[model samples]
Target: MAEGRLQRELNRRNPFETPEQEAVLNLLRTGDLILNRFGRLFGEHNITDSQYNVLKILRDEGQPMPSLGIAGRMVQVVPAITGLIDRLEAKELVVRRRCVQDRRVVYVEITPLGTKLLAELDQPVLALHKQMVGKLSQPEVKQLSRLLEKAREVFSQ
Candidate 1:
């Protein structure tokens, strides 16, 4: 008898085919919205989401990493790690070095500039995350994370 929040938001004339369909749609919609917020924030600093992710991964590792390794760690699978690295290289944020023993392997290392940029963004990024889920209680946040992780397991199959 009652319309769901998502249904109303979507301005749907009909109900979702099933609860599963509704839940998945809601998750996707929410994820896109949250991602857009981060995109704006990243744009303010002239960085794309993928670039930020790459820098963060390299910074966290505390050393140079293989280009493929960086690609694997990316949240979304980026098809052209080379182009991404090239841009960062042009920005002088990161450097690509050929391996000494294995000439075929190119390693990417974050420069001081990249480290500084990430440090500058750390607080803003954290604040944005908090702002997005500010309405949720601590327990609710934990529950939501668990539920998301559980849903993600579907990918393993």
Candidate 2:
């Protein structure tokens, strides 16, 4: 039957035409899977991955930063940062203040509540990082990270 022939052909020929294409597809698929897992983990604590990223960035800076500065640090657009800040502010995780000297500029600062939540998330976040790439040896992880960094360099142009 035609079905049998199709099955035979499929079995004879590999699904991917080239190793490079297969590797790229595999990398994208794996990244999606890992991100999904991380999303669920973060959602359990009432935050999305992006929200956590914003909080962590603010924490690391150790001081309030201009809204544009935060947007620059993030991959998101400038306008979207306003909505994101609104949501975080609504949740009492962060507060926004207008710069006294420059009324046009707004600064975002993480609240104490945000700091407490981040501290709570620390253990689980570290565990998730370990679990995601734990199978790889340290050298392998370092090499993989280096390769990925190099791959990103192409986009900077």
Would you estimate the TM-scores of all the predictions? Answer: 0.94, 0.87
- CA displacement after TM-score superposition, residue 118 of candidate 2 (Å): 0.4
lDDT winner: 1
Q: Where does model 1 exceed 4 Å of error?
A: none
- Candidate 1 lDDT, 1-157, residue by residue in tens: 6888999998989999889998999999999999999999999999888889899999999999999899888755656798899999998999999999999899999999999999999999999999999999999999999999998898999
**What is the alpha-carbon RMSD of candidate 2 to the true structure?**
5.4
Q: Clashing pairs in model 2?
A: none
What is the per-residue lDDT of model 2 for residues 1-157, given as tens digits with 9 covering 90 to 100?
1323333544655456566765676678679879999899999999988899899999999999999999889989889888888999999999999999999999999999999999999999999998999889999999999988998898999
